[model samples]
Every structure is written in structure tokens, then in C-alpha cells.
Target chain A: MKILVCVSKSPDTTSKIAFTDGNTKFDEAGVQWIINPYDEWYALVRAIELKEKDPATVIHLVTVGLPDCDPIIRKALALGGDEAIRVNTDSSDSYYIAAQIAEVAKKGAYDLIFTGKETIDYNGSSIGGMVAELVDAPYVSLATLFELNGTTASITREIEGGEEVCEVSLPVVVSCQKGISEQRIPNMRGIMAARTKPLQVVEPASIETLTSIVNYELPPAKAGVKLVSPDNVAELVRLLHEEAKAI
Target chain B: MSVLIFVDQTEGHIKKASFEALTYGAKVADQLGTTAEALVLGTVNDDLAALGKYGVKKVHQVANETLNHVDTQLYAKVIAEAVTASGANVVVFSHNQTGKAVSARVAARLKAGIVAGASSLPDTSNGFVVRKPVFSGKAYANVSINSPIKVISLNPNSYKTVAGEGTAEVVALNVAVDASKIKITAVNKVVGEVPLTEADIVVSGGRGLKGPENWGVLLDLAKELHAATACSRPVGDAHWRPHHEHVGQTGVQVAPNLYIALGISGAIQHLAGVNRSKVIVVINKDPEAPFFKAADYGIVGDLFEVVPKLTEEIRKMKASA
Candidate 1:
């Protein structure tokens, strides 16, 4: 089985969010980057688990970004990806990125494709379905559990109030979230081997960029909290009802 | 230049978010000086004509049983066809599960630029610029779509739903659908409780609660307030609460009207999921807990004493009112 896992770099969750260039560009200065948690912890890890179950299974990592994304891809490699492909581009548009990934998936002819439910930066939750449409394959979003049997895949996904179980044929695209797999740390051996692994860079497909950021705005800072004595629970309730009008 | 709104339904009932989408779509149509229409895919039990109260001029129903459950490919195909037939330049959706699953595919099929989790209506003064939350609500980005056709999915609870006087003309749309590659086997629905996404008030607990046995106090407060229950990642990881009730970056993200935290030390990740709440109240013994910075109101005291009193006060207040 050949599986293609889509990976992306995201700012560390603890990093303070800011924009520069008249609020038109993200401020990368002093921001730490990491493999997006959903990609590393859930999508890629689940693919690695599938590879572990069957040694013949091959896992390939793919990302659409500039050269700065290499370290994040290497980190994913250390977790168990066999090879990696970088679609050399800087476009963050979801359609452009999905088109690039779909191009790679078409060339590779993989049986299954995986992506993080959404990048923490954009939280669009749109790429997986877009890629599936571009590749003309069935797509599933928010998958929590996945198991492969022969040519069929049984998947479990979270619905509004509960869970839904579904089955699909091979060559399907799935966007993963938590409950799919546990996080894994790369050991010394894997880290050392990742340096020698193949990292291929390909030119991005010619696709029209759809959306552009006009400007960015930070959420307004909170007014200092109104501290109430714990003994005055009624006052807090009254304040909520009167001042905040929240209840 | 028409506006088409996708009305999401499950088990034949329209979702709350769909009403917001309809209202948003109508407002957008008003902004564009066009008419707003709605498209329903499944066999719905609700009154289709009544949806006009939300401002739609027409309701288009497919009346297909197969669409009752989401098949992303089929839904995308049908929606694309509907867009083409109706000559809708702008498509609207509620950024709920169904929208997340299908909107992008429809955009791809139509070669339209799409924005998910749109927070407000478009600014049509110069161009169509829509604002959306980025970095998980830490910031906002105004995105400009240059495509001739555009798709937008509104974030749940972001827009208000207003019902006015009117009845839409219900019409039947006939479109051919192919066999879906995916098949549904079973559904396990959580019953008899407020869904976290739709809750107006949410009461959440965290590691400071200690154990599952101590959850009754938090539940009691939630019950008194008629609020949904949620927990931090640590509490969910430790099995103190069900995974579905976990609200954080990796769990379910919520934006309730009021979020009351009991003993949670708001981590950045946890805040990412819920920072959109209209108001926040934090209660923790540790004065240094990060949650206090984001809270509108805070109490630095033992939750064991604070929670019961708060619940009792709310109950009494309700009784008096």
C-alpha cells in the first residue's frame, strides 16, 4: 500500500500572533515553527502506524511551501515517512496548494491520501476536499479512525453530536484530526536517518490563485478582568445579568 | 448575480447554523442588489416555504433520500450543477460539519475562490472582501476573492438569524447523481444533551478538578445554568470527561455567548478553541492562571465553595425572575 501524507509547517501554538507590513503580512520574526500538530500527531502518525502494521506499506510526505519548510518535512521523515516531496512555492491559497498536492498524488498513484483536518494558521478545513476534487477521488473529512482491509477502507468520523462509521474503496482522500492516533517522538536513530533520506523539490503546478489577504487585524485586547470576591457569588451573577448581559 | 445558500440538515431537520447562513446570504444579496435563494439537498421534514422568513426569496429542494447522509462527491456535484443552473455568482454555507466536508469541493468544481469560517458579510465598497478568523481566532484576516464566482462558509453563531414576514416559493430541482464511492454503516448519536456547537452558555472544567468523581459539582452548575459541559485537553486525556466534550485546538472549538471555566488554567491551545466566546468567566484558586487575562470576570477562590454558591445564586435568580 502506498500512502501520501500532506504536511505543513505552523507557528508553535504558544507564539504570539502579529502582522507586519501594514498588517498585510504575518510577522515571522521571533516565531517558532513546528510540524502542524494535526499533521504530525494525527495524519502522519496514523500513516506511520499503518506502515508498521505492514512493512510493505510505503508512506510519502508532501508539502507546499518554500525552502523554510524543509526542517518541518525532515521532522516528519524522522517519524517514519519513507520519502518526501516539496512543491516549491510560497502561495498560501488553499486552491493553489491543493492543486499542487493533487498533481503529486496523480503522479504517485497512491492508494490512500492523508491530510491534517486543517492548518492551525488558516483553520479553513478546505484543502483535503479540494485536493480530492482535483484528483477525482472520494473524500472524507474529520476522520477519527481509519483501518484498511485489502482494497477497502473503514473510517470513523465525528458528526455533530456523535460518530459516523463509513467505508470506501481504495484511492481515497481523508482529512484527520485527534482520536486518529497518538503523538510520536523521533528517536536518535530515526533522526540520524532522516538526514540521509531523499527530499525532492518539484515546481508548483500553474493554478490561478483564488484569495489574497488584504490586511490583518488582531483581536482587541480584553479590558482587565472584574475580580469579585468568591463570597459574593450573587454579585457575580448580577453583574453577568446586568453589566455583561451574557446570561 | 444571485446568491444561493446551502441549507444543511441531519435526520431531516434543518441545522441552526443554516438560518444564520440564510440571513447572511440575504444580506449579501441585498448588498449586491440581487435576490437570495436557498438549496436543500436531502428529504427534509421542515416547512421549506417558511425559510423565507430568514429572507430567502425561493427554496429549491432535491428531495433525494440518498442525500440525507452526506456524500461529499455527490453533494459537490449537485451543488455545482445547481449553481450553474441558477446562475448564482455567490454561494453561501454555514461553516459546520457539512460545509467543512463539501464546500471546497464545490468551489473546486466551479473554479471559484472559497473562504471558510467567514466571520461577517463582504465589504462591497471597493471589492468583495470578507473577514475571517485566522490563527484560531487570535487574529482576523480580510480576504479578497478575485474569482468571478465566489464561495463562502460562515462560521457557526457568527451571524445573527432574523425571521421576518414572508413565505418563499418552493421549487423542485432535478439533477442526476452518481453512486457514491463511500457508504455509511452506522451512526452513534449523542442523545438528550445540548450540542456543544449550538450552546449559548458553556461550563468547562480542567485538570484542577482532579478526578472524574468530582465532576458532579461542575455538572451541577452546568445543569443550573442550562449550559453545555466542556473540558480542557488534560481532563479529556485523563478520561475525566468524554473526548467529545474536550474543547481546545485539537478538540471541538466553541464560541458560546458565555463561557464559565471551573479550575482551568487556560493554555494557549485551549484558548484557541474558545477565545471567540462573547464573554468569559474564570474561577480558579491560582491567581496566576492564564485564563484570567482573557476572562471578563474572575474569581480567585476554591471552586469547591465557589461553584455551588454560584449555581445556587443563578437558580435563585432564575426563580425570582
Candidate 2:
């Protein structure tokens, strides 16, 4: 089995969000960049698990970003991937990123494609579907468990109120979320092996983006909590009715 | 110009997000001085024309066995064709899994400006700018669609589904659909009394409920309210609830009408998921719980005491009604 796992560089989840340049762009200053947690924790680990199950299987790491992202790509290689491919360009937009990934998948003819349900940064959850569309394949998001047999893959996902089991043919796209697998850390041996793995760089495919980010801003500061006397339970109800009007 | 809404369905029935999209599309159609129409793919046994109660004037069905399952590429192609055939300037989607998949594909195919996770109707007073949650529900961004054909994917539960009086005219479209690229091997459903996404009311518990054994109170309240049950990430990680029921930054993002949180401190990640809920009620013993800051109503008491009382009161009211 050949599995392609998509990863991206995003600001760490704990980064203090701030904007610069007249509030038109996110300021990356003093922010720690890390592999998106969803991709790192679920997609990568799941790929490694699949590879572990089949030692001959190839797990390739793909990312759409500048050369600076290579360290994380190499780290992924160290984790378990047999090879890595970096589309050497800043991600243009979701479509552009999907197109670049699709370009690689088309040439490589991967049997299965894996990506995080949504990047922790953009949280668009669109790329997996977009790539599936670009490649004219089936797409499933938030797959909690996935297994492969012959030319088909069986996946179980939570949908609405129930768990939904779905099967899709090979060359399909899946976005991984939590519960897919426990998070894995790269050990010294895995990290050292990643240094020797194949790291290929390719140019991005030509594509036009349908949308662009105008700017980003932080959420409003939450108001301090209102503490009502524990004995004044009725007063709490009165405040909810009168002040909050939420009851 | 008309607005065409894609009504996504599963198991021969309409998805809840589709209704929310229908309502959103209808309101947008009203805003654009046009009527809303629907294009339903696959096989649905429901009354197609009766969807007019949600403000659709006509229902277009393209029932092919191939379409019983969704193929994003094929669906996008057909919808783009429908938008052209119907002369729809505005297209709306539900931004759910289906909507997230197909909307961008349709937009790319048509070169239309696309906005996903739209929380409200466009500000048509000026140019077409739609407000959507950005930074994972932490902020809002108003994006302007410059393309002639504007696509908007409404965030689920962001808009109210208002019922009105009308019947739709069902028209079967003669579009040719290709063979499905995907196959459904098996559908293992986790049967539950309530679906978390479709639930009007959701009751979520966190680690503060102490252990999984103490979750009886939550189940009692959820059962009384006919509400879906959810848990925080920690609780799910601790095996207090199924991982599927975990709703937070790393879990499901839901927007229900009423969200009741018990024994959960409002972490930023958890808040990111449920901030879109219309109403939040927190029941926590801790007076300093951060969730109360965002809650519209909060009860300062132990869940063991408050939840049963609330459930009993609700049950009494239900019995009387």
C-alpha cells in the first residue's frame, strides 16, 4: 500500500494571535511554528501505523510551503515516512494547495491520501475534499478509524448522532481527526532514519484561488465572570431573565 | 435570477444541515429579490414539493442510482450546470461535510467567489460581503465576493429554520450523471437516541463530572430534554465518553440552539467549538469556571443536585404538556 500524508506548517496552537501592517496580515513575530497538530498527531501517526502493519508499504509526506518547512518534513520522515516531498512555495490558498497536492498524487498514483480534517490554523477543512475533487476521487472527512483491504478502504466516522461506516475505493482522500490513533512521538532511531529518507522538492502547480484572506483579528476579550452569591439563587434567575434575557 | 440550494440527503432523507441551508438560501433569495429553488440529488422518499414550507418555490430532482452516494466532482459539475441552467446568481450550501466538499469545487469550476462558514446573510446594502467565523470561531471576517456568481456556504445552526406555508413545484431535471467514483462497502452506524449534530439541545459534560460513573446525571437530563449528549476532550480521552461525543477544539464543532455544559471549565479550545451556539447554560460547582463568562445562563451548584432537579422539572412540564 502506498499512502500519501499531507502536512502543513502552522503557528503553534498556543501562539498569541496578533496582526501587523495596519491589521491586514497576521504577524508571525515571536510565534512558534509547528506541524499542524491535527496532521502531526493523527494523519502522520495513522500513516506510520499502516506502514507498521505492512513493512513494504510506502508512506510519503507531502507539504505545500517554503523550504523552511523542510525540517518538519524531515521530522516526519524521521517519524516513519519512507520519503518526503515539499512543494516549494508558500501555500497560495486552499485551492492552490489542493492543486499542488493533487499534482503530486497524480504523478505518484498514490493508493490512499490522508490529511487532517482541518488545519488547526485555517480550520477550513476544505483541502481534503478539494484534492479529492481535483483528482476526481471519493472524499471522506473526520474518519475515526480506517482499514484497507485489496482495492477498498473501510472507514468508521461519527456523523451527527451516530457512527457511520463507509467504504471507498482506492485512490480516495481521507481527513483524519482525533480517535483515529493515539499521538506518537519520533524516537531517536526514527529521527535518524528520517535523515536518510528521500526528500524531494517540486514546484507548485499553476492554479487560481477562488478566495483570499483579507485580514485576521483576535476575538473580543470575554467579560469577567459574574459571581452571584450562592445563597441568592433566585437573584441569579432574575439576572438571567432581566440582564442576560437568555432564559 | 434565482437562488439554487443543494439539498443533501442520506438514507433517502434530507440532512438537517440542508434545512438550515434551505432557510438561509430562502432568506438570501428574498434579499436578492428572487425566489429560492432546490436541486436535490440522489433518491429521497420525502415529499420534495413540501419543502416549500421552507421557502423554496420549486424542487428539482435528478434521481440516478449513481447519485445515491455523493461524488464531489460529479456533484459540483451538476450543480454548476444547474446554476447556469437556472440562472442563479447566488448559490448557498450548508458548510457541513458535504457543503465544505462541494461548494469550493463548484466555485472553482465556475470561477465564482466563495465564502464558507457564513454566519449570516450577505450585506447587500453595499457590495456582496458575507460574514463568516474566522480563526476557528474566535473571530469574524466579512469577505466580499467579487465574482458574478457568488457562492456562500451557511454555517450549520447559524440561521434559524423558519417554517412558512407553501408547496413546492417538483421538476425532474434531465441532467446526465456519471458513474460514482466511490463505493460504499458497509455502513456501521452507532445507533443513538439523539444525533449530536441534529440535536436542537445538547448536554455536554467535562472532567468535573468526576468519573464516568457520575455521568448518570447528565444522561438523565439529556433523556429528559431529548437532547444529545457530548463530552469535553479530557473526558473523552479519559474514556468517560466515546471519542465521537467529544466536542471541543480537537473534537466535533457543533452549533445547536441550546448547549448545556456541566462541570466543564471553559477552555479556549472547547469555547472555539461551541461559541456559535445560540444559547449556553453552564452548571458547574466552581464559581471561577471560565465557561460561565460565556454562558447566557449559569447555575452555581453541583451537577448531582442541579441536573436531577432540572430533569425532574422538565419531565413534569413535559408530562403536563
Candidate 3:
């Protein structure tokens, strides 16, 4: 089985967020980057688990970014990916990225494709569906559990108030979230092997950039908290009703 | 030039998020000097004409049983066809589960620029610019879509639903429905008084509550407020609460109107999921807990004592009001 796992780097969750260049770009001056948690902990780890069950299963990591994304892809490789592909481009538009991934998926003819539910930075949650549409494959988002049997895939996804169990044929796209797999750390041996694994770079497909960022702004800062004394519980309620109007 | 809002439904009932989308779409239509219409797939039990109260001019139905459950492939095809037939230049959706699953595919099919998690109406003064929360609500981005056709999915709870006195004309739309490639075997629904995503207010607890045995205090407060109950990651990890109730970076993200946290230390991961809420109240015994920094109102006291008194005060307030 050949599985293509999509990987990307995001600012570490603890990093302070700021924008640069007239608020049109994220400031990378002091930002620390990590493999997006959903991609690393759920999508990539689940692919590794599938490979462990069947040694013949091949996992290929694909990322769409500039060369700065190499270290992040290497970390994913260390986890268990057999090979990696980098679409040499720096674009944040979801359509452009999905189109590039679709081009790769078409050329590779993989049986399954995986992506995290959404990148933490953009939080769009649209890539998997867009990729599936471009590739003309069935897509499932927010998958919590996945199992493969022969040519069929059984997947469970979270809906509004419940879980939906679904079955689809091979060559399907899945966007994974938590509950799909646990986090894994790369060991010394795997890290060394990753250094030898092939890192292929390819040009991006020619796709029109659908959207552009005009500017960025920070959320309004909170007015300092109103510290209600523990003894005056009724005052808090009065404040909620009269001052904040939140109740 | 018309705005078409997709009304999401599950088992024939319209989702609360759909109402927000309708109101938003209507306002956008007013901005564009056009009419706002609604498109609903599958067999619906609700009064479709009454949706005009939210400002829609008409409600279009496809009335197919297969669409009762979401098939992303088929839904996208039908929605794309509907958009073309109706000549809708702008499409609106509530960025809920169904919207997240299907909107992008529809946009791809129609070759339109799409924005998910849109926080505000498009700024149409110069061009169509929409504002959306980025970095998990830590910041905002103004996005410009240059495509002739545009698709937008509004974030849940970001827009308020406004209903006025009006009735819409219900029309049946003719569209082709393709067979779905995926088959749903079972659905396990969580039994709760309020669905977490749609709740206006949420009451959450953490490991500081001690254990599952002491959850009654939280539940009682939630009941009085008519709010959904959620938990921090550790509480969900320890199985004190179901995994669905977990709200953090890797769990469910919520933007309720009011969020009350009891005993949570406000990890960054937890804050990412809920920083979008309009008002936050934190109650933790430790004065230095990180949650206090993000709270609009805070009380540095034991939740065991503070929660009951707060609940009682609210009950008395509600009783007299």
C-alpha cells in the first residue's frame, strides 16, 4: 500500500503571534516552528502505525513550502516516512496548496492520502476537501479512527453531536484529527536513517492564486479583568447583567 | 448577483448555525443590493417558508432522502449545480462540520475563491474583503477574493441570528443527485441536553475539580445556566469526561458567548480553543493561574464555594427577572 501524508510547519503553539510587512506576513524573527501538531501527532503517526502493521506499506511525505520547510519534513521522515517530496513554493492559499498536492498525488497514484484536519495557523479546515475535489476522490474530514482491509477503508469521523462510521474504497483522502493516533518521537536510529532518505523537490503546478491577504490585525486586547471578591457573589451577577450584558 | 445560503440540517432538523448564516447572507445581500435565497437539500421537517424571517427572499429545496446524511462528493456536485442554475455570485455557509466537509469541494467545482471561518461580512466598499480569525483566533486577517464567484463559510457563533417578521416563498429546485461512494454504517450520538458547538454558553471543568465523582457541582451550574459542559484536556484524558467534551488545541474549538472555567490553569492549548468567546470567567483557587490573564472577570477562590454561590445568585436573579 502506498500512502501519501501531507505535512506542514506551523509556529509553535507557545510562540507569541505577530505580523510584519504592514501586517501582510507573519513575523518569523523570533517565531519557533514545529511540525503542526495535528499532522505530526495524528496523520503522520497513524501512517507509521499502518506501516508497522505491514512492512510493505510505503509512506511518502509531501509538503508545499519553500526550502525553509526541510527540517520539518526531515522530522516527519524520522518518524517513519520512507521518502519525501517538497513542492518548491511558498504559498498560503489553500487552493494553490491543494492543487499542488493533487498534482503530486496524481503522478504517484497512491492508494490513500492523509492530511491534518487544518493547519493551526490558518485554521481553514478546507484542504482535504479541495484536494479530493481536484483529484476526483472521496474525502473524509475530522477522522478519528481509520483501518484498512484489502481495498476497503473503514473510517470514523466526528459530526455535530456524535460519531459517524463510514466505509469507502481505496484511493480516498482523509483529514485526521485527535483520537486517530498518539504522538511519536523520533529516536536516534530513525533520525540517522532520515538523513539518508531521498528528499525530492519539484516545481509547483501553475494555479491561479484565488485569495490574497490585504492586511492582518490582532484581536482587541481585554480590558483588565474585574476581580470580584469571593464574598460578593451577587455583585458578579449584577455586573454580568448590567455592565457586561453577557448573561 | 444573488446570495445563496446553504442551510445545513441533520435528520431533517436545521442546525442553529444555519440561522446565523441566513442572517449574515441577508445582510450581505442588502449590502450588494440583491436578494438573499436559501438552498436546503434532503427532506426537511421544518417550515421552510418561515426562514424568510431571517431575511431570505426564498427557500429552495431539493427534497432528497440521500442528502439527509452528508456525502461530500454528492453534496458538492448538487450545490455547484444549484449555484449555477440560480445565478448566485456569492455563496454562504456556516463553518460547522457540514460546511467544513463540503464547502471547499463546491468552491473547487465552481472554480470560485473560498474563505472558511469568515468572521465578518465582506467589505464591499473597494473590493470584496472578508475578515477571518487566523492563528486560532490570536489574530485576524483581511482576505481579498478576486474571483468572479465567491464562497464564504462563517464561523459558528461569530454572527448573531436576527429574525424579523417575514415569510419566504418555498420553491423546489431541480438538480441531479449522484450516488455517494462512501457508505455510513452506524452513527453514535452523544446524549446531552445541549450540543457543545451550538451552545451560547459553556461551563467547563478541569483536573482541579479533583475527580469525576465531584462533577455534580459543575453539572448543576451548567443546568441552571442552560449551558453545555466541557472539560480541559487532562480531565478528558483521565476519562473523567468523554473525549467529545475536551476543548483545547487538539480538541473541539468553541466560541460561545460566555465561557466559565472552573479550576483550569489555562494552558495555551486550552486557550486556543476558546479565546474567541465574547466573555470569559475563571474561578481557580490559585491566584497566579494563567487563565486569569485571559479572563474578562475572575475570582480567586475555591470553586467548591464560589460555584454554588454563583449558581444560587443566578437562580435568584432569573427567578425575579
Tens digit of per-residue lDDT, candidate 1, span A1-247: 9999999999998898998999999999999999999999999999999999999999999999999999999999999999999999977578888899999999999999999998999999999999999999999899999999999999999888788999999999999998899999999999999999999999988899998989999989999899999989999999999999987
What tens-digit string does per-residue lDDT give for candidate 1 at B1-321? 799999999999999989999999999999999999999998988999999999999999988888898989999999998998889999999998889879999988888998899998999888899999999999999999989999999998889899998999999999987888889999999887778887889999998888999999999998887789999999989988998899999889998889999999999999999999999999999999999999999999999999999999999999999
Clash totals, every prediction: 0, 3, 0
For residue B46, model 2's alpha carbon misses the true position, in angstroms, by 2.7
Write the residue-wise lDDT of candidate 3 on A1-247 in tens digits.
Answer: 9999999889999999988888888999888889999999999999999999999999999999999999999999999999999999977688888899999999999999999999999999988999899999999999999999999999999999889999999989999998899888899999999999999999988899888889999998899788999999999899888888888
Off by over 4 Å in 1: none
Docking class of 1: high
Candidate with more favorable, higher TM-score: 2 or 3: 3
Candidate 2, pairs of clashing residues = A161-B195, A161-B196, A163-B190
lDDT of each: 0.93, 0.81, 0.93
**Candidate 2 deviant stretches above 4 angstroms:** A227-247, B124-127, B190-192, B313-321
TM-score of the first chain of model 1: 0.98
- What value of lDDT does candidate 1 attain over all alpha carbons? 0.93
Interface quality of candidate 3 as DockQ: 0.82
True contacts kept of each: 0.81, 0.39, 0.77
**lDDT at B65, model 1:** 85
- Error at B141, model 2, angstroms: 2.5
Arrange candidates by DockQ, descending: 1, 3, 2
Clashes of 2: 3
